[model samples]
Target: MVHSRVSINIDSWKKVSKANKDQIFKEIHHDYAVEDNIKKPLLKKLGKMHRDWRNRLRSGF
Candidate 1:
């Protein structure tokens, strides 16, 4: 199967005005905090992965 690439150009922001930059930064920070909140459960799952891996290695899996 082939997958198409999706891309964003970060340097395009250089052409944006200062007011737009501030607004974008606020939105970015808001989204980041929301994302961190949403990822709490996934972070817990990651902790479990590490614990499971340790147990399997200890048991010579």
Candidate 2:
């Protein structure tokens, strides 16, 4: 599936469809490979984690 290059706000994550959310999770897992063996989390929790991670990365710079 071809994912668009649109930038989705973390706040909107929970509003997206389950398929889209799953795609997002798959993309993140593909890049980071950290979701292996972990139970999939709810979209809200996923968004929070993504937001926190982005903040940490930004702060480290």
Candidate 3:
């Protein structure tokens, strides 16, 4: 079984502090050893993932 490197639960994304968000990004980057050139794409992908999760929760899926 594969396990996630970072475990963060977003009960209220909007209420998440900037510091917490930064910590999440930092952990992901460190875990993946993301290249500087790919950092932007990684962030974009994370955003899309978050949006999809939020949409699913909102739609009761």
What lDDT would each prediction earn against the true structure?
Answer: 0.56, 0.58, 0.69
Candidate 2 runs further than 4 Å off: 1-22, 25-41
Best by lDDT: 3
Model 2 lDDT, full chain set: 0.58
Candidate 1, residue 48: CA error in Å?
0.5
Worst 10 residues of 2 by lDDT: 3-12
Tell me each candidate's TM-score.
0.40, 0.35, 0.51
For 1-61, candidate 3 gives per-residue lDDT tens digits of 7634433344357867978877786677677776767876666677668878879989999
- Per-residue lDDT of 1-61 in model 1, one digit per residue for the tens? 7643322232354556878767755655455565666655544564466557758978999
Higher-scoring candidate on TM-score, 2 or 3: 3
Cα deviation at 54, candidate 2, in Å, is: 0.4
1-61 per-residue lDDT for model 2 (tens digits): 7643333363365546988767765676565655534523443465566668778877995
Q: Rank the candidates by TM-score, best first.
A: 3, 1, 2
Rank the models by lDDT, top first: 3, 2, 1
Report the backbone clash tally of model 2.
0
